[model samples]
Each structure stands twice: as structure tokens, then as C-alpha cells.
Target: MSSTPSTVLDRFLRYVQIDTQSDPNSTAQPSTEKQKDLSRLLVTELFEMGVLDAHLDEHGYVYATLPANTTKYNVPVICFCSHVDTSPDCSGAGVKPIVHTKWDGSDIVLPDDLSQVLRQSEHPDLTAQIGNDIVTASGATLLGADNKAGVAEIMDAVYFLINNPDIKHGTIKILFTPDEEIGRGTAKVDLEKLGAAFGYTIDGESVGTLEDETFSADAVKITISGVSTHPGFAKGKLENALKIAADVLATLPKDTLSPETTEDMEGFIHPTNIEGILEKVTLGFIIRDFTVAGLHEKETYLKRILENVLTNYPHSTAHFEVIEQYRNMKEVLDQHPQVSDYALEAIRRSGLTAKRRSIRGGTDGSRLSFMGLPCPNIFAGEHAFHSKLEWVSVQDMQKAVEVIVNLCQIWEEKA
Candidate 1:
């Protein structure tokens, strides 16, 4: 009953067919009730596999345990985790997965939309997937591979371990979280009950990547207030707040401080939303940097721009607010080097050259690391995530499952 490539592919395709897009504006724990759709299904499958404790909690998280089959009590408890919710940036409803069996190194034109093409040059990983089975959506919606691929790989790995009891391993924990795409994946996690010494998030891009660092994140809000007056008498008395807000946006550095302009450790001050009227305007921004000092610097620069813009409009005033989101996971991961080292070793045992990388965005692992569970991210073969062109190779997904299995064995052997 070992999991073959077909098992992983089948699970991913089925999971994506269900809509589980999380909501960022929702204040609820799960953000969207539909996320529980996949959560319930995962619990049912886990229970059928003999993991009787598998159940969805009040917060819509699915937690289960795979008891250690080994006599080594000293082996540390390890958890394999992934999120069930997909990103809200794109539509995840009614996904139709298209499988390209035995890719022939040609550009993949999505069926639903010919304009949405997966170019081999844009996706260098496709070079290695030439002969592998690649899965994608129909171009009308995102493939949900960002984390669903991770969910399937984790489930298949559990199935393999349970079916092959001869494989010695430590007590393994399985966690499927909701609202991760909204940045609240572990908000209600009961770490005391989980009791795992360490964990790994199967929520990264590419097959050979093991990410230990993530960008330190912050949220910023700027509000502008302007005088309201009749248009007929507005010659010298009225100052439009909407115009002031536009000025601030226009003043933001185009080449140095934007998501489109920054890359590879360079931080950015990105304006995510702007809404305003003639009298009042609000601007929402997300700030990201690899270091705390860098985050602060970007915030300071942003405020300076707002101040300078308001200087011209004497009657108008502005307010700037900064909210702490999450910090770099490396701050905590550095304290426990073995957590990442074991994963790199496991990747090698799975017959792939390990590549240590840092993500430009944050993950559930980033939040968990600061929440007392030192967790790093492992690759799940996702590429071009949060887009209609997103895709993943079945062969790479199987390799990720192998890494999870090897990681379990390495923990027991080292113990």
C-alpha cells in the first residue's frame, strides 16, 4: 500500500477541485467556512487510515498522530505540517486540473485560456520535468498547488509509513491548518497538545529547496484628512485628500521600494490598497525585509514621504500607523541548527541535491518558529504560485514525500 506517484497526484487533483480560498478581511479564525470542506475530508481520510485521533478542532485545524513504531524513546517528536487554505489573491473555485503526461519540452498553453501560457523559459524547473507528469489548472483559476500539493504529499507520506510498519521512526505528528494564506494559520494552534520538539512546513517552491529564513513583515496604514467645502467656493479653501493620497503613492520610490522592483534580500514598502474620497483617504501597505532594522528603515522612509507631502497642503493632516506582522524565522532557527540540517540530509537521502534558500514572503513555519515550535519549510514542487499559470510536477511531489519519510528515519537513527 505504499504511495505511488499516482496516489499523490490523485489526492492533489481532488483537493484542488474543492474551493478553499481563505479571506484576509474576515476576522474569524478560519477566515472562511469553506476551508473546513477540505479539513473535514482530510480528517475522514486520516481516520480511515487508522489514525483514529484525527479530527478537526473548533478552529478548523486537523491534527493527528502517528505513534512511533520504534523502541527508541529518545527520538524527538517531529511534525509534518501543511495548510488546507489556498491564497485569496486568486480564485480557487472549481479548479480543473490538466495533466501533461510525459512533457516534451514545449510551452504549455492552458486549456481554459490560451493567453495564460506556462513558458519553459519562465519556469526553469520545467526543464527537469521534461519527462515527468506535470499538473496545472485550466487557466481560469489558480492550481492551488501552493499548499494543496504540500497537503497531498504529507498525506501520502503518512499512508506510506502506516502501510510499511517495518520502517523505524519516531512519533510523527500530522497537522493541516486553515487560513494560512491569510497569515493566521497557527493563530489558534495548541502547541502544548501538539508536543512536538520540531516541525517542517511542506509549503515551499521547487523540489530540492529547504528554506529556513523568511522576510520580516509589517503592515502600515496611512490616513489623510482634508477640508470639505462646496466646489463653487473651493478656489482657495478646499484641499482634496484623495489628491494628497495620490501624491504619497506617486512619491514612493519606484526603483528601490516596491514588490516589483525588489528581489533577493532587498526590502520593499508596497502599497497594497488605497481608498479615498474628497475629504478622507486611507492607504494600506505591507512592508518586508530580511532584518528588523531594514523593516524599520523602510517604515521611517515611508513616513517621511507622507510628512513631506502634507507640508504642501497646510490644511490637511496625515496619520501613519505601523503594525507588526511576523519576523524572520532564521532568528529562531539559528538557535536550533539541527532542525534544518536533518532536513538537508533527508533531501540528499531522497536522491536530490539540497538547496538552502530564503523566501521573499513569510510562511506558517515563520509564525510557528516564533511560537515555540522551531519549524522550517520544505519544498513541495509548487511554481508560479497564486497565479492561473501555477503548476507542479508529479515526479517532484513524490520526491518531497520521500524527503518526509527519510526525515522520519533520520530522526530515529540519530536518536
Candidate 2:
């Protein structure tokens, strides 16, 4: 709240200790009730900083507003967003964050688990954090810096704007969402109540990077029902569902169109889950691409593979289903060039060279863009997220705060 460098780090430290891991198998809006533990605390902290409108909704969303300090009436309302929940890929419980103050740039061995190590060779991003304070979690859990660093930076920027009223800016909005890790971040957000013309999600990685494009995504499920018979009399009478499903998976292309083999602009269809018995089996997959046509092409290709595999199991019947996920945000951002231009200018004003790039994964902004808010992503300096080796730099977080503060002023100036 004092605009000090420690404010962001302190906030980050406080946030990462909370166990806010979201469950992908849950049916609730947030996918986890523990997510509210962090949301409630955020609201209280915002209220302490003079944000009277700060409140947490029933769906575990935290929303707050900072009134305009400028005389200009044309400044568009801008919102800064981040997610509260950490990924389900790793454990986030009982997190112990350790800050390496003025780090000398060496491999960090997590205290909880001797085997867990953060090496500069594996993560090239550490090469840039030579003299900055680096934060990481104990060996057993993730640090939760994926988006909490963004949350802290936004909080610090809001506090700076509040204390320095002379630095004029337009009305600003703050939104903290839950379940972004499970793809439900924007599922229950009230856009009309938010009422922001343009927005930015402080959820990117690296320093001085802005992302306007993201992968268009979809989920596919294939269920197979096979004829079953007792093992003793199962010579030709038994068509095992598990074996049928395995055949389909094995038939998929192993050298191409996968998460491990794709990079940059390449698309991937990833098999995420498979569960079954002798009579029935369900296979789950996620398809990602930069375009709608690409998504369809991959989906069709996957189905073709499934169909060909089913030819060997005549008695087995299968059902294929596809679920629509968020699309590429660039399709919407292209209509509002000023949204990114102002952000780039703000980053430059903060004394950093801005690099406009595209993310291989989707963010909360991807859906919010189509929801009538042209939101892009800003860097929060998080690396190796959703793992025990997840880390964030204090200097990088402070720079994010400066970028956010500058963005407010830039929007007011351009108005």
C-alpha cells in the first residue's frame, strides 16, 4: 500500500501460501470451495486500502473499483484481471514460499524435497534474474505464482494510484477470478456489472511481454461399450472395452500433432484422461489450434483415427463427443488495435522494451474478449508455473506494477 518494492513481494508471499487448487472434475462454478478463502482475503485487503466497493461474489469472484482522478470524461473504463486458483497439475496445499533475496543466479534446491531442484539450464528465464529476488515454493508443492503475482502487482498499482491522486487516471476496475486453471475462470463472471470497455489480464509470463493471441481450444470424449464375457469362456465372445479404447489411442499419430511435439504456431491434440472397465471405457482429449478451421481439422482427424481402430472391434460401439472451449482472442482484439497500442506505450513508458507475442495456451482474457471486453495479457514474470519449480522475480513484479500504473495514465492521456 506504500508503493514500496516489498509491498508486491509481501502480497505475493501471503497469497501463495493459501491452498487454492481448482479441481477439474468438479461441477461447481469455481470447481473448488477453497478458492473463496483467497477471494475473501483479497476483498478485505482491498477494503483496507480505501476500495469501498470491493466485494466477493457467491461464485468466488472478487470485484472492486477505483474512481477516476482525471477531469477527462472520454477515458474508457479499463479492468485488470487475474485468477485466484492454482493449477490441478500440482499440489498447492501447505505451500512454503522461500524468497532468495538478491539471488546470485545458481540452482535452487527446494528444502522440503531434496530431489526437487530449479536449474538455470532447464529454465532459461532464470538467466535474467541475476540480481533480483527470486521466490519459489518448497519441494512438495507449487508456488502458485502463475497468476498471484499478477494479483499482487495489480493490488500494488491500485494502492499507488489511490495514494498518488495527483497522477490523474480514468476509472479503473479490478477482477479476481477463480477456476482459470480448470477452464472455468469466466464461466460465471457478470460482464454487465463489470462494465469495462477494454481490459487487461495480468497473467502472462516473461518480462515486458504482451499477448494478444491464444490457442482456440476444445475438449473431446470417446466412450466405448464392448461385449463382455467371462474370461474362462472369452475366446471370441469377449470384446474388451479397455482394449478397444487402447487400440484407438495407440492408433493416433505419435510423432506429430501432440503437445510434446508442437511449438510456436503448430497445433496439438492431447490425450488427457482415460478410464474404463472391461465393458465400458471413456477417453478424454483436448484439441488446440490458432484457428477454428484448425480445430475442426484436428477433431476430424482424431475421429478418423478412432473410426479406423473401431474396424477391428466389430462388436464394440463407441460414441464421440466434442465440447467447445474458448477461441483465439486475436480475432476480437484485431478489431480494437488501440487496446494493445496503449498497453505497449505504457510498458515503454515504464522503461521496458515491450514485446508483443502470442501465448500457446488460453487465458481468462480469451473468453472475456468475446464477452465484449477486448482484454489482452500482460507479463507477471512467472516461470515454470504449475510445478514445484514455479518461480517469480520481485523486480519483475515491481515492473508490472509500474506498467499497470502507467497504463491508467496512458489511457487518460490518450483520451
Candidate 3:
């Protein structure tokens, strides 16, 4: 391949430099107001690309439209969506994107932090990028390629469609959402305003991967109340809430049923937060599985763990509450098979073998699918996302751009 990079690479480099990390603890729709910075910029770029209706709303979502170019068939409107916000798991500020041109198969040591090294052994996808340009953060911060790469790819695809009007296509909608990392990507999304019959979130990892199945998710909050007493007078009378919470956690299976122990298709009970005093403590957990049955099974198992732990402390009481997060999109996607079939054909047209797989986590598409959009996830070439070791390849992004273009054309042709 030539050393020349595509416009998608430039767009990705430009977008990642802007810090848009979403805060999980915030109550705002976007969770972080700074996320709108990227949303606004995306709108500006979309307007510059001749997308007249491109605008950012108060909810930190950038919506735009590429009018239909084909008059032959009544093609259903489709959308290309991506999140602008990065994860709070790592610093997204001052992201110095280092593009290693024609990278050899070697470990990449990020300059800012010498200990932050990217090895092919750790990142299996690097083997395919033997001579391709690889992008990484300058240590101490994430690359923001998680969905910024998707954002740039969608931007370029829209730009391409506008420039090459001869490549006939139906009306295509563009959406740039915020706070996806904190699970609020579609919190304020106005689907009626978007008006897309189908959608694709270009936010998956690997070059040729397309994901339609996502984890059915639920959030569990456990509040433990314990008898608090004076330390000097405390004996058997003291039932510390912190100790009760610790006991429950300690009782969880050490070799299984955890994020650290789980692998492909395996669901896990992940403890996200734990906070409290000796009198009361709140433990937060997230349960994930492919099926709704499996999802509930995990939740039941968890409640059982809590019950067993509380039996030892007769004075202590616990409350377990389960909040529905999102369900497996595959349920809705299965009913609209054409959406994924068209995507697979498009991926094949992009000169790559389609690698269809299930996502271990959820995406905005998960909620959108049940919301009547039948959206699936497409690859954006992002890998090891939400961490300093995150990376993307220039060649892979260009291929993603091609896939987007082909997918739109496929929709037009099929219509």
C-alpha cells in the first residue's frame, strides 16, 4: 500500500484532539457539557460539507441529513450514528494522536509514559497492520478512537456522498451522540426527529466485524443497613455496614462469574461502585447476558449471594433493586434481517470478509433497535477502547469508509 492516507485518517486525528470524556456521575443529559464541543464541531463540519440542516441541539446531539439522490425507488431512510464522547475510564484530555506510518510488527512505547507499551501480543489485530499506519495516544490518555474513529468515518462518508452525487443513494441521516460511554447515548434522542427507518452505529472493533447481538443489561443497587454503635462500647452489638458489604463481595465466586474471569458469550456480574459508612453502604453492580433469561438468572444468583451473606449478620438488612438498562438488540434485529444482510453484502463489497459476531457489551443500537430503528453495529476499526493502549489503523479506517459508502449504495439498490 502507498504511504498516502485517506481523508478519514485526517478527520480522526482532528476529532481525537478535542477532549470529550463523558462523566458517569453527572445527571445532565450529556453528563459532561464539554461533550457538546465535539458535537458542535461536527455540526460545523457537516455544514461546511454542504449539509444545510446540520445542527446541534441542547441535548448534545448533532443531527443532519443528506437528501435522497435517487428518484428510481422509494428507499427507506437510513442513518449512520456514532458517539462523540469518550469514556471516563481514562483521561481523554490532551490526546496527542501519534500516527506510526508503515508500522512494523513491534511494541509501541508511548512517549509520555514509558510503561505504556502497545504490544502485538496484547493487541492481536496489530498483526494485520504489519505495514499499515497505526494511531495511538501519547500515554496518560486514551486515543478516543472508540467512537471518534466512527465519527470521522461517518463524516467522511457523508462528505463522499455529497461530492459524488452520481453514486445514487436514499436519504441518509447523520447522528453524533454524546455520553455513550456513560450509557446515556440515546438518553435524549428524538427518534421522530431523526426519522430514519433503519440505522447503523459505526462503533465496533476490528476491520470487517459487524455486530447485531449485544448483552441484555441490568443495573443492581444493593443497600445494606447495619447497627452502628460507639467503638468503645461495641462488641457483638456492632454490625458494620461496610463489613457486611465486604462479606457479600468476598463471598462472590473468585474463579468465575466476573469480568476478569469471563470470555466470549459469557456474562458477568460486575461491581461498578461501592460507597458508604459503617451504618449504611450502597453497592452497585451491572449484570449482562445475551438472553433475557440468562440476564435474570445472573440477577437471581446475585440476590442469592446477598441473602446468604446477610444470614451471618442477623441485625443487618439489605435491599436489592434491579433497574433495566438495555436488552439484547438481536431480538429486534432478528425481525429485520434485511438490515444486517445488506450490511454483510456491503462489507463484502468493501473487499473484506465479513466477520459477524456478538458484542460482549451494549451500544446505542441496543436501545435503538427496540425503539423501532432496527439498528446494528458496524466496525470503525477501534480496538482496546476506553484505555491508554487504544489504537486504530489508517488503512482500517479507510476500509470502514468504503464499507459505509457501499452499505448506503446497497440500501439504494435493494430498495
Off by over 4 Å in 3: 1-5, 231-236
- What do the candidate models score in CA lDDT, each in turn? 0.93, 0.92, 0.92
lDDT of 2 by residue, 1-415 (tens): 2444448888999999999999999998778999999999999999999999999999999999999989999999999999999999999999999999999978899999989999999999889889889999989999999989999999989888888888999999999999999888999999899989999999999999999999999999999999999999999889999998888888878889999889999999999999989999999999999999999999999999888888888888899999998899999999999999999998898898999998999999999999999999999989999889999999999999999998998899999
Report the lDDT of model 1 for residue 137. 97
Query: Candidate 2 clash total?
Result: 0
TM-score of each: 0.96, 0.95, 0.95
lDDT of 1: 0.93
Q: Evaluate residue 59 in candidate 2 and report its C-alpha lDDT on the 0 to 100 scale.
A: 92
A best-first ranking of the candidates according to their lDDT comes to 1, 2, 3
Write the residue-wise lDDT of candidate 1 on 1-415 in tens digits: 2433337888998899999999999998889999999999999999998999998999989999999999988999999999999998899998999999999999999989999999989988888888899999999999999899999999999988988898899999999999988789999999888889999999999889999999999999998999889999898889999999999999987778888987898999999998889999999999999999999999999999999999889999988999999999999999999999999999999889999999999999999999999999999999999999999999999999899999999999999
lDDT of 3 by residue, 206-313 (tens): 999999999999999999999999999999899999999998898889998999999999999999899999999999999988898998899999999899988889
